[model samples]
Target: MIIKTPRLKKGGAKNVYLENVSHAVTRPAMESRRVQMYLLMLLADTAVLLGSFVLAGGVYRDQWPNEFAMAMGWAFLPIFLVIAVYQRCYSIRALDEVRYAIGQAGIALVLSAMLCTVMIFYAKAATEFSRVMLSLALVAAFAGMALVRVVMHLVLRRIYGPSVSSVLVVMDGGPKVDIRGAQIVHAEDFDISGVQSSPNSLDRIGRLMRGMDRVVVSCAVDQRTKWANVMRGAGVRGEVVSTALQELGAIALEREGGQSFLVVSTGPLALHARIFKRGMDLAITVPAVLVLSPLLLLVALLIKLEDGGPVFFVQQRMGANNCLFDMLKFRSMRVEKLDSKGARSTSRDDDRITRIGRFIRKTSIDELPQLLNVLRSEMSIVGPRPHALGSLAGEKLFWEVDADYWQRHALKPGLTGLAQVRGYRGATETENHLKDRLEADLEYIRNWSILRDIKIIFATARVLVHPNAY
Candidate 1:
C-alpha cells in the first residue's frame, strides 16, 4: 500500500495571520543620534569633571591636577559608565519623558556623587578639590546630558507631535481624525502607531519617510495580542519597532542591535539558569520555612476550619526545569478539579472559593505553603508567577502578550513581583492586561535588585489592605 503524506503550505496557518499585516505609524528616526548623544554625555561629563579640577587648581594657584588626581580621573569615567548601564541610565526607554529624564539624571547624579565622594574621601583628595567646582561639573553634566532627551522630544514632536515620531501614518477607523487634540485626536497621542486601518496608508507614509524613521504599530482601537505582535515585528530594517503604548510611554523601548534583542522570554528560565536559581531557592527556602512555620500552621488550621476539606491542596504545577511538582497550597477551593489547567484567577466571588479562602487569597496567606517549594528549591520569592503549563492557553490569556512574550520568563517564577504590586494583582486580565503585567515583571527581572524585591514585598502588603483587592 502506498502511503502519501498530506501536503502542507510553507507559510503554515500562522503565516496567513501575519502576511496581510502592514505597519502604519513610523518609529522615531532619532535612535542613532540619540545613542551617540548618550555616549557623548557620559564621556563629556567625565571630561568636564576632570577639566574643572585642573581649572580650579590653575585658578587657585595649586599647580595643575596632581598625579593622584590624574589617576582618579582615569578611573572615574569607566566607573560611571558601569553605574549608568546598571541603572539603565543609557537606555532610551529609561528617558521616557522630560520628567523621567530629570528623574533618571537625578539618580545617575546621586550615584556619581556617592562614588566620587567615596573616592575623594578614600584618596585623601577631598580637601584638595574645590567643592563648588565638583558640584558645577555634576550640574553641567546632568543638564548637558538631559539636553539630548529634550532635543529628541522636541524634534520628535515637531516630526510627529509627541514622544519620538518623526513621521505619522494613521489608519482608517471610526471617526476619522479631523483635529489633532480636539474631538477626533491623532492616534499618536495614545501611543497607537499603525495606520488607523487604512490599506496603502503605510506605503504612502513610507514613501514620505524614505525609510529614515522608526516604524511603530499604533493600535487605534484595542489591539488583540496577535495583531500587536505582528505590527511590532513589522518595523523597517533599522528603525525602532514598538507598541503605541511603548512609544507613548517613551521610556524603555526594547533594544535590538546586531544579534542582541534585549527583551527575554520566560521559557528559557527552566532550561538555562536552573542551577543558579536552585541555589537561591535553597538559601531563601531554608530560612523562610524556618521563620514562617508557625504562621503556615495557623493558616492551615484556618483553611481547614473555614471549609470542611483537606487543609492542603496539592496540584501539579509547572516548576523549575519544566518538571512536574506537586505544588502545595492551603486549599482555598471547596472542591478541587484535577484538570484545572484552565482554571486561573480566583475571582471576587468564585463559588468554589470558601469564605476564609477569600481572605487568605487577598492577604496572600494562601501562598504561604509555597515556602515549602522554596525550601525544596522549586520556586523563588521574586520571579514570574508559576502557571500550569498546559492550562495557561498561551501567555495571551494571562499576560499583556507581544511578539517577544515568552522572553519574560528568563528567570525562575516568583511568588510576587513588579506585576502584582503595580495594581495588576487579582484576576480577569485580558491578553493585553496580562502582557502588561508580564512587562512589569520582565522589567523587574531584567533590572533585578535586592531593593526592588523589598519594594515588591512592601507593595504586596499594601495591595492586600486596599479595598480593591477583591
Candidate 2:
C-alpha cells in the first residue's frame, strides 16, 4: 500500500475539458507562477498608463479633463486592457502554444487602442497628440510585456522540466494482468507531460505513482487477480480512479511533489493546423492594417458622400467555428430606399448605386473598410470568404458540392482571396459558380502564404482595372 497523493486540483487552465470557470483552476505547480504572471501584467499595464499620461502633458488643458481625471483615465486604460486580455484569454489559453503568448501581445495592443479611443472620445488628453506616437507606445508595451512573459516561460520550463507534468501508477493484479500493467508502468514519466506514465515494474511504478500526491487506475486494472484487487483496494482508498487510457492525454498535470500525487486535465485548444493559420494571420494582417489605413478612410468617405448615408455597413457573418462577427464593408448602396431589410447583391442596373457607389463597387472600393476589420481582427487580408451560417442559400450552401467546404473557413475569412482574384465575385446565384468559388477558396486555405496573398492582390488589381461594367 504505497499510497499515492496527487497535487493538482481539477479545472486547470491547460485542458479545455470542462467549462464552469470562475476562471480556470490553477494547478499546484503553477500556483506561484500564475500569481507572478498576473502581478507582472498589472505592473506593466500601470507603466503604460503612466506613459500615456506623460504623453498627454501630465493633464488635459482647460476645458479638457484635469489632472486627477487624467490619472483616472490612465487607470481605466489598464482596466480595459486587462479585460480585453481576459476576454481573449479564454480561448487563447485553452489553445496554449509557444506562439500564443506572442499573439496575445498584439491583442493587448488592440485593447490599448480601444482604451485610447475611449480617452479621445472623453477628451481626457491632448487633442493634437500624434497617432503615430500612440501606436509606437502601444507596440512597445506589447513587445515589453510579451518579452517578460517569454522569460517567465523559459524560467518555469527550466525550473520544472522541458515538459509539462506527468502521472505514473504501478498496479499488481495476477501474473496475467501483471505484465501489461508493468509494461505501461515502465513508460514512466518519459512522456514528461501532465499525464505521462510508466507502468512497467510494479514496485518501481508504485514508487513513482506514490511519489506524486494522487494517482488513478482504471476499473479494468482492479480485476487482474485477487491479490491485485486487494492492492488496488488499498490504492483506491488513497488514490483517485480514472481509465488508464485517459491518462494518455492529460493536458494539465497536478503536482504534489516527491511524496504526493494529484492529477488534472482540461483546456487543449492549440493544435497543428490551427496554430499555423493563426501565426500566418498575425504575421501578415497586423502590418497590412498599419500600411492601408489611408486607403480605407478615403474609400469610406467616398461611399458616405456618394450615397448620403453611413460610410460603413456591418452585417452579421458566421466566423470560425460558427462564431459570429459584424462583418464590415463600405455602404455601396443607395440610402433613399424606404426599407433596409431586403438589400442584396447590386447588379448591372441596380437602383441603389450612386455615380460614385457604382464606380467604387466595380473597382471593389467598398471592400476597403474591411482592412479595419483586419486590424480589429474580425477578418483577414486573404483567406476563404465568410458566409452567414444561416445563409439565405439554405443547407445547400454547405452540403452542396463544395467538397473541401469546412477547410476553407479553417482560416480567417478574408477581404480578398484566390477565389476573388480568379473572378468569383458578385451574385452567388448559381450552384456551379458557388462550387467553383468554394474550390478556389479551399485551394487557397490548403496552400496559404504571404506570397500567395500578394499574387492574389496583384491579380485583383488587374481585374479592378477592367471593371466589366457590371
Candidate 3:
C-alpha cells in the first residue's frame, strides 16, 4: 500500500477513488474529540466559578449566596469564557500542554476579573458588593479551574493515547515520509494526482482527508503548485514536501527527522487577530454608514439626476486570495464611456467623467459606496486596495510589472490603505508607481496592528481631495 503504482490503460490514467483504499486506516475523529473536550472544560469551569462564589458567600456572610453574589458569578463566568476562548484556553494545545492550559486560564481569569471590576465601578455597584468576598471567589475559581485542567489533561492523555492529531501523508511519487501513527496511502491508489482538476478528483481527496487534522503531500516538483492550490481551497492544514522554498513562496520551513517541507498556505491572520480586525471594522463602518447615510443618499441622487445612468459602477477586482469580487463605487463616468475593464487610467479633465463625476472624484466622495463592502466583509477599512482586472502599470499588467504584486491579496482589499494615505493614490502610470504602492501594501500586511489600521483610516481623511484625483 505504501508504493503501489497505478495500472495505466492505453490512453489515460485510471481513476482510483478513496473508497478503494478505505480499509487501510481507521481512527477516531480528532475534531470530535476536541469538541467534547471543549464542552467538558466549559461545563467544569462554569461549575467551578459558581461554586466558588457560593462558597465565598457562605464564608463571608455566613449564608447561601444572595442575588448579588450569584449575579457577580454569572457576570464573571461569561467574561471569563469570552477571554478564555480568545486566549485559546480550551484549544487542542491547551489539552496537550498542562502549563499552557494553566497559564492561559490564569491570564484569562485575571483579565476577566479586572474588566468585571471596572464595569462594577462604573455602574456604581461596587459599594453594593463585598470586595473581599469577590476577590476570594476569584482566587478560588482560578485554583479550581487550574486543578480541573491538570486532571482533565491527564485523563485525556490516557484516553487518546500519545497522538494529539491525525495526520494523512499522501505519497505521490516523491520522497517517502515516515510520520508516526499517520495513515500513509500511495496517491496512485487513491487517484490523487495534483494535476487532477475534476470535481471527483477533489471529492476523492476530500474523502480521504475527512478525519485528518493535517494532509502532507509528497509529490513531484512540477505538481507542487496544483497541490498547494488544492490544499489552500480545502478546509484543513496542508503541507507539501518540497525543497523548492524560493519557488513556492513558502511562509515557513519545517523539518521533521531528515525531511524538509514547505508550508505554503497557513492563513495570514490568527483567530484572535481576525476577530479583532473584524470588530474594529464593524465598530468604525457601522457608525460611519449611519452618520454618512444622508450624504450617500445625496450622492446617489445626484449621480442618477446628472446622466440617468446606474447609481453604482460595479467592476470585478482581484480580492483576497486572488479571487474576483464585484467592488462597488458611485458611478462617476458617462454611461457610454464607462470603462468596465478599467483599461485606461483616468487622466486629468477626462471627457469620460461626468460633470458631477469630476466633483465627487475630486472630493473622493465616489468611493463612499465601498463602506457597504466593508460591512459585507468583502473589504476592510485598511488594507491593500483591490485593482481592476485589466489595470496596467506602464505597458504591462500589474502582475507582470512585479511578481510580488499578487502577494498583496493575502489581506482583504481596503476602501483606503497605507498606499493611498502616503499619496500613492490615482494612476499607476509607470512600473515604479505600482512598485511604490506595492511596497507599502506589503509593509502593511507584514506589520498590521489595530493601532496602525486606525492611523491609516485617519490618514485617509487628509488625502480625500488630492490633485491627482480625476
Candidate 4:
C-alpha cells in the first residue's frame, strides 16, 4: 500500500519547520561562537576559584587545608552554582557587558561566602573555620574572577578580530547604510506607498531572515511598528534607523565612517530573569488571591444580582507566545447584543455599560476576576495587557493597525501593566495610541525585575481611577 503526505503550503507550519531545519544545517560556523565563549568563561571561572582557595590556604596558614576547610571548599561548588543562577553570572548578555559580569560574580562570591559562614556557625564549628582565611579566600575569589574575565575578553577579541554581526536591511526607499565589517545578507527595496496594501511584505521578510543575526529597518515613522513586528516575529534583534533609538537607554552603538548603527536586543528576557519573574508572580499572586477572596466573591454577587446575567465575563484573549486563553472579568456591560468581534471601543457616554459596570470599570473592579487567570498560570499579575481577538484601535483590528502589536504577547498578558499604569488604558483612539502602548509594553519586558514588578503594583494604586479607564 502507498500513502501520500499532505502538500506543504508556502509559509505554513510545515514550511516553517523545514525552513528552520535547513537554516540550522546551513548556518555559518561562527554562529555558535557565543556559546563556545560562554563555556570557556565558565571553565576559566572554576579554575580561578579553585586557585583562589589554594592561594588563601597557603597565604593564611603556610599549609594545605585541614579536613573541615577541604569540606567547605567542596560545599562551595553547589552553593555557588545556585548563587550564580540567581545572579545571572553565566548569561550570554553578561559576556557583552564585562562590568555587569564582574558585578554579578562579586555578588555571587559574597553570597556563597555568607552561606559558608552560616553553615559553619550552625554546626558550632566556628573555631575551625578561620575568619582570616575565609576573608582572604573571598577577596581572592572576586579578584581572580575579574582578572579571568578581563583576560578572556582580550583573548576572545584577539581571536575573533572585532566581532561583526550579520544584518538584514529593510528600508522603504531610504539611503543605504554603510556599515564596516558587517555582512548585509538581504536588502528589501521597501516602498512606503505599497507598505499598507502589500500583504506579502512580511512573507518576504521571513524568507530574507534565514541565517541572519539581526534586522535593520529604516522606514517612515508611521511604518516603524509594522516592520518592528515583523523582525520580532522572525526572532532577530531589530534596529530602526531613527533618532528614537537614542531615547532607549543603554543600546550598543556601531559606527562605520560617517554612519552609525544602533543595535537592538530583541531576544526574550534572560533565563534567570524569566525564572525569577515567574517566581515573583507566584509569590505575589498566591497571597493576593487569598487576601482578596472576600472582595472577589462580593463582586461576583453584585454582577449576578444586576439583571441576572452571567456573573463573569469570560472572553478569549491573546496570551504569551500569541496563544489564546480565556481571560476572566466581571461582566461590565449590559447583556445586550454583545459584539462578538469586540470591534467597538467603549466610550464614557456609551450606553452598553451597566450601572454596576460603570462603577466597576471606573474603579478597575471589573479586572479583579483576572486574579483567577493569574492563579491558573494563564497570566501574570504584571505584564503586557492582553486584547480580545477582534479588539480594534479604529476600524482596523489591533494586529491590523500595527504588525509588531503581536510582540506584546511575548510576555503573558497581565492584570495591570506599564501601559495601563502610565494612562495608556481605555480605548485606543488612533494608530499612534496603540503604537505608544506597544512601546511601553516592550520597555517593561526589556527592563523587567522583581523590584520593577513591585513598583508597578504600588504605582497602579495611583492610576486606578485614570481618566481613560472609562
Predictions ranked by lDDT, top down? 3, 4, 1, 2
Count of clashing residue pairs in every prediction: 35, 37, 0, 1
Best of the candidates, TM-score = 3
Q: Would you list the C-alpha lDDT of every candidate in the order shown?
A: 0.56, 0.53, 0.83, 0.73
> Which lDDT tens digits does candidate 3 get at residues 1-470?
13232334445534533455553353556887788889999899999999999888888878886666787788788898999999899887888789778878887888898898898889998678688988889899989999998899788768765456777787787887877547777665655554365787786666666777888999999878877887777777998887566478677878999999868766679888889999999998999999999999998999899979999999999998888888999999999998989989999968899988999999999998898998989999889999988888999999999878888999999988999999997888999999999999999998787668988988888998998888
Backbone clash pairs for candidate 3 read none
Model 4: lDDT of residue 349: 87
Give residue 38's error in model 3 in angstroms: 34
lDDT of 1: 0.56
- 442 in model 2: Cα distance from truth in Å? 2.4
lDDT of 4 by residue, 101-172 (tens): 888898798888888788878999877677887777778888988988777766755664334244455546
lDDT of 2 by residue, 1-470 (tens): 12132332544441222121101222234435555655665566567555554544323333242454345446546555566557453232412344566565556567667766776678866564445545545555566656655775676566644323322343332122221112123122222222223233343323333323233333334433432343453352233233453445333445565553334322222475446545666777677667877877777767666646788767787665546788776676666652233324445788867777677777777676676677677777677777654432323555454545665656678877787788777665566767878889867765565446767767776676444434
